[model samples]
Target: MKRKYNPHGLPPWLRSIRNVCGQFIVPICIFQGIRTLILPSILDVLLLFLLIAAVIAFQFEMI
Candidate 1:
């Protein structure tokens, strides 16, 4: 008998994390960009920086 092969190889947890990040981070970035264009405030800029840092951390599986 021959063994079957699976095409979808990524683990479930990793796939979920990727989906969540893609769904959440992309929208947050887009919204931040729009907000910055409309009104560039110091607080918003700081928050945007923090958000980008967080995304980078998540991408590296740090958080």
Candidate 2:
């Protein structure tokens, strides 16, 4: 087995935020794909918020 390293060496908190955003976004995408009723009402809204927050965090380097 081989280990890979990131050259930028992101901090632990940034990694955590990225992981959390991925977790939230995946389920929302799956739900949207299924054409669920909640897609527009809830999942879409939640996904939008999560994406906004993730973008801001990355932009400001606050993660």
Candidate that scores best on lDDT: 1
Give the per-residue Cα lDDT of candidate 2 at 16: 81
Q: What global local distance difference test value does model 1 have?
A: 0.75
Q: Model 2 off-target regions past 4 Å? A: 1-8, 36-63
> What Cα-based lDDT does every candidate model obtain?
0.75, 0.61
Candidate 1 clash figure, as a count = 0
Give me the runs in candidate 1 sitting further than 4 Å from their true place. Answer: 1-22
What TM-score would every model get versus the actual structure?
Answer: 0.58, 0.39
Worst 10 residues of 2 by lDDT: 30-39
Q: Write the per-residue lDDT of candidate 2 for residues 1-63, one digit (tens) a residue.
A: 975555258888878877677567555555554554444557666766666676666555554
lDDT of 2: 0.61
